[model samples]
Target chain A: MIETKNLRFSYNGMEVLKGVDFKGEKGEFIGILGPNGAGKTTFLRCLAGILDCRGVFVRGKPLNEYSPRDLARIVAYVPQRVEPSFLTVFDTVLLGRRPYMGLTPSDSDIKTVEEALKRLGIEHLSLKRTNEISGGELQKVSIARALAQEPQILLMDEPTNNLDLRSQLEVMRLARELANDGKTVVTVMHDVNLALRFAKRFLFMKDGKKMADGGLEVLNERLFEEVYGVKVEIGEIGGVLVVVPI
Target chain B: MPMDYEAYTRRKAFIGLILFLSLLVVSLFSLSSGPYHVPLREVLGILFGGGTKDDRLVVLSIRLPRIVAGILVGASMGIAGAVLQGYLRNPLATPFTMGVSNGSMFGASLAIILGAGYSLNSGQVFLNNPYAVVLFAFLGAISATLVILALARLRGLSPEAIVLAGVAMSSLYVALTTLVQYFANEVQLSAMIYWSFGNLARATWRENAIMGVSFILVFFYFILKRWDLNASTLGDDIAKSVGVNIERERLVGTLLSAFITSVTVAFVGVIGFIGLIAPHSMRLIAGGDYRSLIPLSALAGALLLVSADTMARLIVSPMNLPVGVITSFLGAPTFIYLLVKMEGRR
Candidate 1:
């Protein structure tokens, strides 16, 4: 569904993504794991085409060729944190359909937003202002908004960051279900255990390079130490893979 | 949850419709209640070319121009304020905040101190000629806008950067205006003082025509871009994520807003608080949606200014108090009430 070949990005004369190569397919939940400054977020942003970079493609078309409106229909990106706004949840989610909407939202757009809210179990919070909601509910609202875009690929930057335990699990479960429903879901995560439990594929990045890329087999003590400079033990809990630092 | 977004939209439309009707009634009332005391029947007749010569002179030749000019100025200032506030995502953002008013004030002061030949014998100074104060004020306002845009471009067009640059420019212009005030003689001083206070009495049929045309052109531009303004309130990157061409929209929106403000200020002097107060008031009455907010703010602004001008005309009978003075008195209390209401909500 998405591909990048030798993608390079720099900021202030410093190369943050040094010729990185990555690829993804439909119905895949990929977790990007690395330590601080490992270029995970930058790589995600490049894939989302927010940064001007060459060699990034979506469905075999070059990223640069797509207008912002067309590109929004193909990929939805959720930042690490969104500032609370005065708009209600429904209104904020409806903003996701901006690319498809006219001056006012069409019936289809409104229906899509409603479905997204219900999917996230946030239908009750639709009328409340976004600022009046909890951080966890806000995360769900952000996800609901992204879903409202109906994009083929979803990119999230540390969506579970600052979320409570239940909210974190719920979001991961939703991502897993989205992948099951044949959408490409890529997320940058710090919680390796959560990533291991939910994600079907993993990419470990270190110092602006991909250190490992595979299934559960790539997740080992050596890979953890190489990417994060830490030792970890891997086990199975309730038939799900779990990673814990020892 | 099958929420009724349509119902909310309908409610907003109803509120907007009511406000428009109120503005219509207020405008007719203002047209009828001048010193000449043209009756409502005669006012309607004059509008349709059926009234006596005396009633026609009062309604069509004199009162109609001022009323139309007041509406144009109010609507333009209100829309400009709403656009700037939404674009910059700051409640305090207005045309005046961009230093355009101060820049125009400085230019008017310069013309007052230097061009003394245009003063009337009745102790009132008017920028009646296009070659004198009006021309200088236009140049000053346009130049200020261009300079602010250039500085904002240098800093990645951050809202804070633009606002801070505007504040600096505003202070410098104020200091310059004060310096001009210090050097003025009695006639020039009164001219400068009255220009700063903002009077709607100087508007004639010609000026009203120009203002009306400008208001229509710019008002439609804002209406077309209202959705973009809503997207912008979500922050720069997020707005971009939603397919909004942030840089292009910001540039065009700010330039248009500044242009509207320059035209109004060039004609009517620095009418403070209308731009600052009208949009905020509209936001409170309506929701944050820009589609409804823009038109509603325009009507509410016309209503506020027309009502205030009518009151100014009534409080002292024949001698017209500057409409700016009335707006300040009315706007400050409403502004304080809004601030308190906002605090209570939070």
Candidate 2:
């Protein structure tokens, strides 16, 4: 299980994450919903140990207890977008195995990379340059890189931002598959319906604080209006709850 | 969509590069032939078997040392350029861009103005060198590196910050070098100016041996760290997530690049553009895989400088022009052409 207690972060004397508490059990898929500047990325960075925050604890250990490499081995982070000017897809995926390989990669490393690429359906693009590929393909490549690390916890920040309809569905399906495989998956998503459909649990953030954290039934029009500061219509479709702006 | 053609082309390109490097080594020996009229048989005899005293002296003492120096300097600059470019993730990034060359020039010019250049005229000075040219040059290079690195830290050491800092430091060093030139006497100024233009006529077997060993060792280190370089271009966050210690890698990489640049500039005066252009050309040909690009850049760099030095000697006959002048003359037009072509393609 991955848990954060009273995580607080500030940038240039301005608070971005204010005493946030979050938890994710094994095999749980959690979706984070937030507006612009709502501290979604910051919270994820704090969880990934990429940012030093106050009052943060993970797995009964302080954040500082684990080195960057050790944290990376436990949590695999996929950023929103990565535009590398020089690297092949295969090479980018191979970098995910760095913590495991000291000097050179072994045969098992290559097999893991191949399997990750195959799982992401980007095996054909393995030889192409990262910059030359399309945005959706790059997103898949980034996710593939994270998956290749074989971490128990996966953190993604708006991973489906630039993807098309089919690509978005593919990504969500993959996320669901990963969660089914017993990985704790935490993803930041903008689409409310997609999040409700894919994530068993959801956390809503507003003004750098957690507004609500519960199951799909806990999200209603009044709660959405209060959290987003805007009127929204909430309804059920095919047993999945969704919110739309009014 | 097809794999066959790309595989074939890649194989052919690799074979071609190997053949070209071999031919370049042969051309280095052939450079002994011009106006001096050294026979091919005598050159070969001196190279393999012991030959006449005069043949051995000419081949072993003069031509061989110069050729070896050219190869080593070329390889050093090439490898340093590749490493810097990879670290900065910018096509224009180079050791010279960080003010290493201009700083070395200023250090060398200061030594010359202080009469240190002449202090090493005893013929055995190479063995017991007390003049401060090399020491000052190394200090200048390291200080410039520190300045650029410090400025880069202001914006979190992003690639853009590093490049901008390099540009600023380069301009500052150029101004300092100009100031040194203004205070020098006529003879000292001429000597300093010539040294700044670069020459390889002072190559000794001992220096070549030192340079060769350092180049090979550092080159292997770069090869080993190629994966870290590859990951870094993806950005600091991603690189960290992939288990790379970004700060440590950058620190080690910058230090190694500065060390190689200092050693080369200490021996051969300031040779510009080789470190900038060689890596870019290698990237274009080899497709940006540092594992392949680093070694290929080294070979291409060595070949280019050796050929340029040979042409510098033959283009002006006995008056041998500065190798730096020749490289700039050749490199500038090619660089402009590449810029235009890249723009057009875009």
Candidate 3:
């Protein structure tokens, strides 16, 4: 649903994204894996249309050509860390419906927000202000907001950060379910094992470049060491692949 | 279905009602509060054209317009402060943070020293060249906004830097005002000091109409953009993700806030603390949802300022204290108590 050809971005004079190419299709759950400053977040922001960059296309249209409202209707992004403010969890989630709302929220908008919260298992916290919630709950609030957006394409940066083991799995499972339900889901992740557990495709990045792109075959000791500068033993536990650093 | 969304919304609605009713109550109380002390029944009777001519004069001609000015200036400052704080993401921000009040002060002081001074006698005050003072005060307020706008446009200041620039601008305006005061003789200096005392009594029906129009137009504009403001408090990425053009909205919101504040301050002089207290108080009582906040703050602002002005009139009887002084007296302690409560919660 979205593709980029030679996408380049820079902050000041320092180039952060160096001609990275990517194409995401419907029903594809792709995990972008890289260490610190792999241009992962930058690439996700470019796809999300938060940054002004050329050569990024959504459904064959230039990203910059779409108005913010039109683009938001089709593409929703969940950032790495969503700040906790004085907003109730329900209202914060209702913000996702903004692209489709008039001045006042409609009944459908409110219903969708409630359903989104339920999906994230945060329905009980709906009345609670975000500042009163925990880190993991806040992250789910962010994801719930994105889910409420009802976008065709979802881009998440570190969707699992600040989440506990169970919440992380639940969120990753939700992303996978979204992909399976005919939406394109792309997440930039730090935990290789968690990505392997749910994400169907993996895109490895390093030094502002795409290091490898594929499934399990793309992952090996050499690439892991070269990309993450670590020695890892990739093994199976309970028929699921897990990356353990030795 | 599992959530208590109905209860939450109902609670907010209730809060809005209380604020609205309290504002009405305080306004009526202020009407009967001045030197003549019109009774509440006579005040209502005056409204229906059944009171004494003397009572009618005291209630309608003198007090009604001042109450209207209180509502106008107070609501204007309140919403302006709320919008400013939201757009800038700075809790410390008010229209005053951008040097609006100080700039008006500087302008009025300059006018007075330059021969626009009027005599203060027999517990009455007048601006001999009122138009000149208003024009200069407005120009001064707009100048502060322009300088800050230029800083953002030309140099691309971060929101934090813009707030700092506002503080520096305020320092500059204060220094310039003091310099103006330095050159003033005794009468001119006292006039300048009195001019700094925020006076709702200065508003006749004409001034009230202008202030009312400005507040209504600006209030509607911000209310229409409340969702974007809610997204704004979360920061840029999410705000953009939600289809808000944060930059454009920020600029427009800032300009409008500065515009409304300038229009009010030019007529009423510098009313401190109403702007700061109203918005923050509403935020604490009802969370900072701009949907509720924008209106709630307006009510709270009107309620706070009119009450402060009334107390200023009633405290010494016959002689009036500066409304700004009363606002500071009410605002500082209340704000401190809120901060302590907020921090204690954590």
Candidate 4:
């Protein structure tokens, strides 16, 4: 399990994650919904052990106590943007096996990378350079690289940004399946409809603070106005709650 | 359509083998094609100890030491450039472009003006206190690394920022070298200017041994960090998530690269463009997978330098145009061709 207690992060004096508190249980799927500059990414980074902020604890220990490799074995982070380079997709995904292998990748490492590419449906692009792939394929490649790590907890920041609609649905489904398979999955998302449809729990953040946290009970007309600063109509569409801006 | 990955890796391995074989051929050709020319078969005979005394003297005493120097300097700069490009993720990043050479120039210049009492008479440069110049040049190169490392650690500068810092540092070192040259008399100034024109003949067996050791150690270190280097090319966030201590690797990588380059430059003076050209050419041919790029770039560097130094010795026949001038002359056009090819592909 991962949790943060009153986490606050300042970027050269201006606070981004101001006293944000959160926790995730095993097998929980959490969709962190927020507007721009709402500290969602910063809070996710803290959980991934990339940020050296106080109050982030994993598995009953403080974040700093674990070695980098140990933390990596437990948590994987997919950033908002994955830079394209000269590496082939297979080689890029093979980088995830780094913490476990020594000198050169072993057979198991190769198998794991192949499995990851297969799972992400990028096996066809294995030998192609990342720079040559389309944006949506690149997003899948990034997720496949993260998945190659086989982390128990996955943290994604806007993983579906460059993805098309079908790819976005596939990613959400994968996240949902990972949570169902007893891995903790947390994603910071801007699309509320997709989040509401696939993720069971939601945490709405605004101005570097958590404004709401719960299941469907947190949804209401006033909540959208408060969180996104826009009026919206909330209704049930085929048993899933839908929010339409009015 | 799916590409065959196993075949792709096999192709890269084949390319690497070809590069290694070519390096061998270049080395032998270098051994035979000097002013006191020995035939290739005779060169092989000399290698097996059956050549005439005069042939042995020319091959063993006059040519072998400088040829060995070329191999060491070229391979050193090549590996340095490859790893620096990997770490900084900047296409233009190399030990030369990162201000190490400029810093060495400043240090050599300072050593000259501050009483090394070097003299250049009728275009033949001589340094009385060569060791002092070497020491100061090494110190100057390391100082540039220290400043950049400090900024990266303290200020958390991005790769782009670090490259820009190198540019800024290079300009500063160039200006400082010019100022120091301004204070020197005719002999000292000319000595410094000639020193900056990389001469392979300056290295003897002792310098070659030192350079050989540094190159071996650094090459193994980078080989060990191949996976980390691969991770780094994807950017820092992904690298850290994949359990690489990116900052530590960056520091060690930059320091070791600078150390080897400083040793080479201090011994042989500044050999430009080998670092930039060798790695990029390999990347274009074999991709940026450090596993192959590391050793391949080193071999390519050696082959390139051996070829260039041979041409330098033979171009004017007994008047060796500085190998640095040859590298720039040849490197500029090849680099432009690569650039245009890359753009055309894009």
Number of the top-ranking candidate, with DockQ as the measure: 4
> Whole-model lDDT, candidate 2?
0.78
Local distance difference test scores for all models: 0.83, 0.78, 0.89, 0.88
- The digit string of per-residue lDDT tens for model 2 on B1-346 reads 2263247348637844783667465564554565675777677767786688877877788777887888888889988988887777776778888778878877877777777543233322221232477677767776788877766555467777777877788788889878987987666666666567677776688778878888888999999988888878787778878877787787678778877878877877777777866676766555567767777778777877888888887887877888999999999888777556534422
The DockQ for candidate 3, computed on C-alphas, is 0.72
Using TM-score as the measure, the top candidate is 4
In terms of TM-score, which candidate is stronger, 1 or 3?
A: 3
Candidate 1 residue-wise lDDT, A1-246, digit = tens: 899999888887898888888899999999999999999998998887777789899999998899999999989988887767656788888889998977778889989999999988999888777767888888888889889999899999998987889888989999999999899999999988888888999988877888998898877788888788878888887897787888
lDDT of 4 at B172: 95
Residue-by-residue lDDT tens digits, candidate 2, A33-77: 978788988998887777777655656677678887787787899
Give the range of the ten consecutive residues with the poorest summed lDDT in model 2 chain A. A54-63
Point out where model 4 deviates above 4 Å.
Answer: B1-3, B120-123, B343-346
Reproduced native contacts, each prediction: 0.37, 0.61, 0.70, 0.73
**TM-score (0 to 1) for chain A, all models?**
0.97, 0.96, 0.98, 0.98
Maximum-lDDT candidate:
3
Please write out the lDDT profile of model 4 over residues B146-234, one tens digit for every residue: 79889999988788888899899999999999899888999898888888899999999999999999999999999999998988988
lDDT of 3 by residue, B44-85 (tens): 888888898899998999989988899899999999999988
Which portions of model 1 show Cα errors greater than 4 Å? B1-3, B113-121, B128-131, B182-184, B343-346
DockQ of 4: 0.73
Higher-TM-score candidate of 1 and 2: 1
